[model samples]
Target: MSTPTSTTAWVHKTTIKPTEKFIETLQKQDLPLPTLGPKDVLVRLHAASFNYRDILIPRDQYPFPVNWPLVPMSDGAGEIVAVGPQVKSFAAGDNVMTVFNQEHQAGRHSIVSATSGLGGALHGVLREYAVFPEYGVMKSPKGWTHEQAATLPCAAVTAWNALKDIKAGQSVLVQGTGGVSLFALQFAKAMGAFVVATTSSKAKEEQVKALGADVVINYNETPKWGEVAKKASPRGEGIDVVVEIGGTATLQESFRAVRMEGTIAIIGYRAGPTKDGEKEPGWGEILGSICQMRAIFVGSRAIAEEMVSAIEVAGLKPVVDPKTWTFDEAPQALDWFEQGRHVGKVVIKI
Candidate 1:
């Protein structure tokens, strides 16, 4: 491993408190390198991706509770430089990635203990170097880049967890052109499931179709895009699974598109109210609309491992866009992400 640098990262200060509006400036730090414990491994982060939850948590709309002045990202990928004495699963040359639940390393949700996520409660990987417990990291598949591996932990695993039991030839409905939604499209297609993806712009209709979506609906052209989604399938049967990302603006339509006894994974709310003055809908109304199969947050590490295996077996490739900034340009990257024009994942190279 190379010598640890004194100027390893750019840290962001608490722009907004826990219950305030969004703030976008990052405060740089000249602090010493982080020290590792006996059971820890230090990772030099190469790239980190943005999630809708990352954008909303700082804005104080997300339900996941967290502290201020925290590094705000849940997904990252990097290489291990140093390992504690007790560590045996990895070495200095190993390329590993972090998981969403630090304690839930490799099992179902019930088997794992509840620990705070990296970018959730504790300091996150927006920094250049982060120290993680040996259990929280996993070995990346051979030949995958740090950026591709970094995109998997949260959004990719969530899609895998939602569709793990789905049989081949089943149908899934993915909403919009976001990170999680795109992962749902790719993974569902790899699983041999018929996919129907939605977009507000007709120009993107061919984009989703190119990604193996059997049907594409322009929500802007047809306010009831769900009706169009239903007609795309055989016998007018509704979709067997719906990856519901639109919280209030399109939740009822998701309900209308789902088949009886089908599943809907409520991963995120990317297109809801942004400002404080706008009127927000009620939860009862939202839940009342999604009167379908069980709804879940994300999957466990076991599910994540299953996803990795599937991706490797099927040669699945993550739909990553491009890096617009480096570690020093974090504030700009976050600002660009808030605008919501990018198609795939927006990453920061550290």
Candidate 2:
């Protein structure tokens, strides 16, 4: 792990260059120590994780919003080193995570802005230190490490928002063992909902089952995983919630599997629909016509607060493994995430 020097560190940072020459052009440049804003908290970062969005930024293909020469990541966890005078919710030494949308602190719909997000239009937390507004920070649950807490803001919170209204004894179907799906399974089980999970790899079937999934469907073995998911739910009652991470690849099947009025949280496009002979509908047609309601992104800060409370109340712990990499190994960590070998969240220790 990289250590801090002089209460500050020589941080190796990543940035985007418009030349499109090579990603290496965004090299390990030195950044001056990060400073706290009046209502901001300066966090001494221990670890940060990569999301699909992080991978897309370097390739110049990310769909959301961004700017160049930006440090690239939205999720991170660390101890609070200093808090501005007006901050009272958290103090120095508290382990906390910064919000995905820095500007939108509360409510159901977030007001998206270019300057608020990390790793795109604004500076991200790939460095040894990061400063965030106190309103965007949340104290991590007791007994969770910085690495584990780092995975919550993006994928995990999206899962929580997706199933927030689900009731006890209801059923949920998760697409695969990716970050959002796996987190959904654990959370849903703890909510007293029966879970049906799927995986292309047989090796991960038992692993999903052990995570409290009532049924694990090996999609490789059964091509129609939607049918399997239906059968697994009691009396073919169908799923009340579906954590839809496969995007176009599983959208049609998701439509078939979910009960009428059930909700699907569409989170990713990694597993595209055209692959494996799955048919994909045009987004314009599907958006207004097929699904009655759709949630495009994670909920607001108020939702994040509710999720933290539910997590504590249910004693739900996020599953994360530290993916430590020396300053030189950052590229390899990104490559591994691109290869999709991880069962849980992947983090880089700086």
| Per-model RMSD to reference | 3.5, 3.9
lDDT score, candidate 1, position 103: 68
lDDT of 2 by residue, 1-350 (tens): 34222232222234335543323444666666545667988888887787888777776667666766666678888998788889989888899987887776766553464246777666777777777788777888778878778888888878888888888999988877777888899888888998988888877887898898898888788867776676678768567787887777777767666766677777777775467644675676455333444665765677788888888888887766445664356666776787788877788776
Among all windows of ten consecutive residues in candidate 1, which has the lowest summed lDDT?
15-24
lDDT tens digits by residue: candidate 1, 1-350:
47464435455465456433233455666656656778888887888888887767666676655766677787889989899899988898788878887766555454334446767666778877878888888887668999888888888888888787777888899988888888889988888898888897876787788899888888878877776777775557778888888776666677778776677677676767434543343676446545465555666667787888888998888888764568777877777787888787887777
What ranges in model 2 sit over 4 Å off? 1-26, 33-35, 110-115, 276-278, 281-291
| Candidate number with greatest lDDT | 1
lDDT of 2 at 128: 75
* Full-model lDDT, candidate 1: 0.76
TM-score of each: 0.89, 0.87
